[model samples]
Target: MPVKAKATYESVRDAVNQLEKEGKEVNPTNVLNLTGGSRSTVYKFLSQLQDEDTKRQIKKPLPELEDLINEQSTAIITSLYEICKHRAEEVVLTEYETMKKRFADLQKTAEHMDLIEEKYQLKAQNFELQELKLKTENQELKEQNKILKDQVQTLKEQITALNKIINKQ
Candidate 1:
């Protein structure tokens, strides 16, 4: 099986920027397709992008204009409002997709962990069986050793008895 690529914020951010530059809608699915990253990763970067945009907007001072330009200001504000609304929708969809993907990844990880735990349990059981076999063999060897020692003692006693009889004769 092919290893999945690790996703990074920079990669997702670049992909989203590229898509935006190409006049494509910056949503989680599109970013995921472009960057080949999980929905969560792409959405994270997109959220960062949105935060940066918001901060920039907050910091920017409104442009001073003459009374004659009031009509242009209203048009500009309307356009900005539309853009913000669209961007908000994209963010919402991206978040939803991210949550879905994250949940899926968690499930896969959980399943994998369960498999690993099962393998370890089997390994532990095998080790315990081997240990038990070794213990039984050790006990058998000890019993055999005791029997040999008793036989040696009996042979020694016989040898001493024979020596005494031969010396008397």
Candidate 2:
């Protein structure tokens, strides 16, 4: 059997972080080589990592000012809140899509199994029908054989009587 790929979020994230630390570009092939993850898994997690980086950049704290204005601080906080909310929504959407795809795949597998089961049932029924037909044919042959044996016994009795009469004459 082929070895299953271990491609969890933590594994992919760690691989990407490690590659970045080594000043290497984080791509599907590099991550696969480093983490032994499949291309699809690496790509999926890479996109998530990119999204996280984008969210982190967007939520970066503003530089301290000598004269901090209350309005500017409130506006910055509100902006950060909005960015966080948007990123959260995007994450939820991604999870929903993934779950939907998994459910669909499961449904297809169940349907395939049902079809296979139906075919097996049909074959078993056909085998039973054939067995019944053979049993009936065997019974008919046995009855015919019994009738033939009875007729041969009657002919032998007649021949014995005729031989006795000839001997007397």
Candidate 3:
């Protein structure tokens, strides 16, 4: 069962890129429609394209990709596949996760600061109330001391007058 693929690999690659640029699904059917090729040939081409893109993403030649590309006695395709879903989507996911973690850390730090602020605010209010109470108590004690001194002075004067009268008699 030989593959009677009339469309060249370049045409297939161009079709996929155009479909992706238009924000369309880069499946075999769409690719087939754009490139006007046999369904089987489109499938094979799409698979090869995805593999090469994956190889580039890993930044090294993968054994699987080598085996795949080698198995194909046809031309070696090094083109792009959703914009190369395995590669592009992975990059997007990595960036998204990094940002999410950063956001969570900042939220935790903010929560800690809020707790510290609340603790200080409550303690300062309590200290201010305690200070006010102490001032009122001190004023009352001073008034009582003045009254006691005046009573002691009056008692001394009365005792001295009585002593002088007894001596004269």
Best by lDDT: 2
For candidate 1, write residues 1-169 as lDDT tens digits. 1223755777777776788789999888877776675777777778778777755654555656543365466558657867987999899999999999999999999999999999999999999999999999999999999999999999999999999999999
Which has the greatest TM-score?
Answer: 2
- Kindly report which residue pairs in candidate 1 clash with one another: none
Model 1: residues >4 Å from true position, as ranges? 1-90
How far residue 1's Cα lies from its native spot in candidate 2, in Å, is 56
Model 2: clashing residue pairs? none
Candidate 2 lDDT by residue in tens digits, 1-169: 1223777777888888888899999888878877675788878888788768766754666555622454466568667867986998899899999999999999999999999999999999999999999999999999998999998899889889999989999
TM-scores for all candidates: the values are: 0.46, 0.54, 0.47
lDDT agreement with native, every candidate: 0.79, 0.81, 0.77
RMSD after Cα superposition, model 2: 7.7
Tens-place lDDT digits, model 3, residues 1-169: 1223476678888888888899999988888777776887887788788778866654644488775665452222333344465687699899999999999999999999999999999999999999999989888888888888888888888888888888889
